[model samples]
Target: MGGGNTAEQAREVLMDAAEHLFVTRGYRASTMEVIAREAGYSRTAIYRQFANRDELVAAMVQRTTQRHMVSILSRIPAGAGPVDLLVESLVIVASELVSDPLLNTIADQTADGTIASLIANDSGLTELVKSTVETVVADGTPFRPGLHPNDLAQFIIATALSFLMKTVPAVTDPAVARSYIETFILPAILQESPEPRRVF
Candidate 1:
């Protein structure tokens, strides 16, 4: 194999090993020595690729978030009604946060202040969701008065994260969480009320 390919492979190996250790062992308890041993490399080799454990964890979080954005975008049904599409997008994000191993690890590690700061500084996910909403609004979808599409999109993302935090542990069934989002959030975003049907 080429030297560059070998180096790339080693980096992937280190990241995979670090992700597993960081998730299973907790970031504070998982030392570089342990990660090196897990990755089948010496401490020096690990340091060559990553300056420290924090950098390694940040890389893992970036990779995880990118994968998450792809997953959410893929699940958005084509030609869906605006409200339904928005709800599905929010649910996809919440589901990922609830189920994804890397995100779970980041949530765990966030207790130490590193992961929270990383997330607060990172707006990639927010921007992606905002762009999607802008597309819908540009396509002439209706939204409630006083709520700009971009602002509503940000609110949806924030609400999804909040719902994931509150309900993930207690609600094992996804339907329950979806119901809450649809019932509570959909009405707020709707632009029109249903017309009353006349009795025949």
Candidate 2:
């Protein structure tokens, strides 16, 4: 409220309250007034930070996912090959998303297409993944000759996010998920390989 840092701290506090309400009361039912009350802020104060409930939710999602992804990416070993990086990322990211409480609440609202729209419109999420892909590719691993890092990053994001909104039978089994990535996903982005490399 006093300056940029104060306002940012206030926003984080609001987002923390919103996450609790959204997870416990469900995203569809957690209105702005409810969130404001939970955060111990007036409705007017909430509006000063976010234009609407949708905006607040989007900001929360971005913050939560960026933090989660950085943790996941850091767990991947440095200089990992393209296959290992992509495969481990897809498996681990998708698995964690399935188990997250807030994401589960969002997924439950998929009948209204909220989850789909969130994923489709989130350029921040895509850019984060793309930046990670570009950085990892600098390690001299051979991806497909004509592949663009952004394109590959998009594919991984799309695939990883699919599990967020729905139960994927194939991916429920880690081995099957690995097989799908190795068989279909890896070949699309990686250079010709007679066999998939086992990284775990």
Candidate 3:
């Protein structure tokens, strides 16, 4: 048990260094050696914790994403209706991704569409959003006919990533972003309830 705790602590220290290096020096430039040195550990120590740079980066990204999701979920009201919860979650995610320092650094540095690929694949961010979406709709929330929760989650993740990547015209304005989600996105997934719930 003590050894497990020590290992986990070492991994956290390495990840903290990786985050700083990846944000400041850019992802490709922050090699494992430099990350180890930055974390005050020998180069070989990093290998003990992580098989390769990719695994280390993945760990850092997963940690950061989990932290981000915690912040997102906390800001959302506990009593929010299903539509409101989903809309608010998507809006908050888009807002944060646009301004996220590490993600911005990575996106700015990548030339081979790495960020786009991450979105398309079931990466950490996608899985996090999918899990949230499933939770939101778990109470038998009605959707467009025949659309599964997983499909809706994927669509929402794609839309949020598109906003982050600015693949479409930039919805920089919050009002415009909320409107876009409410108008185009909500109607597609959410059934037209007679109650007309306000998603604001």
Candidate 4:
């Protein structure tokens, strides 16, 4: 039992190390040997856990995505308003994508298909977003006319990601990013007369 636990802990460490390296350096620049060295593991040990760099990268992406979902769900307030919940969720997602090294690495990768597959396979995140959207719509805060809650949820998630990818590298100031979301993005998303804005 102790050996199994140790192996699991080592795998987690390797994944965390790989994620950091992959994000700081592009996929091509990150090698299994480099990951092993950074993780303080032997090349053979890394191979025993992960077949290759590609597998390690995939695992890291999946693990990070899972953690983000768990964090978001845990932070959501009980009995909160749907639209409010959705906005908070978006903020959380955006913050995580901006700060998480594993996600940064995956976003930088040119292989869109692989990234899409990773997201699609991760149902927990999608389901949480979908359920939150549905709750908001059902709670009388209907989405913009003609926009399905499901589609809107998807758009919100995708747009938040795209915005982060495009803006984070260019803007050094955190306030600018927050301002853009407040002054532009939020208004565009909320079609109602009284535009929704973050209260706090």
| Cα lDDT computed for each candidate against the true fold | 0.65, 0.74, 0.71, 0.62
- Residue pairs with backbone overlap in model 1: none
TM-score of 1: 0.64
Instruction: Give the residue spans of candidate 4 off by over 4 A.
Output: 1-11, 32-59, 69-79, 92-97, 111-128, 131-141, 144-153, 167-200
- Which candidate has the highest TM-score of all? 2
Candidate achieving higher TM-score, 3 or 4: 3
Candidate 4 lDDT over 131-185, as tens digits, reads: 7566567534635566676676677656656644654443324445454455555
- lDDT for residue 36 in candidate 3, whole number 0-100: 88
Selected candidate, larger TM-score, 2 vs 3: 2
Write one digit per residue (lDDT tens) for candidate 2, span 1-200: 32334678879989999899888888877888888888888889889999987778778877888888778779989877667877887777555667788767666564447665776567777787788888777645778776787887788777776756544665745676677677667777767744765423
Better of 2 and 4 by TM-score: 2
Sort all candidates by lDDT, best to worst: 2, 3, 1, 4
Error of 2 at 129 (Å): 1.5
> What TM-score would every model get versus the actual structure?
0.64, 0.83, 0.79, 0.56
lDDT computed for candidate 1: 0.65
**On a 0 to 100 scale, what is the lDDT of residue 136 in model 1?**
69
Q: Candidate 3's residue-wise lDDT over 10-61, tens digit each? A: 8999898888998888878888899988988888888999998766766766
Query: Candidate 1's error at 118, in angstroms?
Result: 3.5
What's model 2's overall lDDT? 0.74
Error of 2 at 177 (Å): 1.8
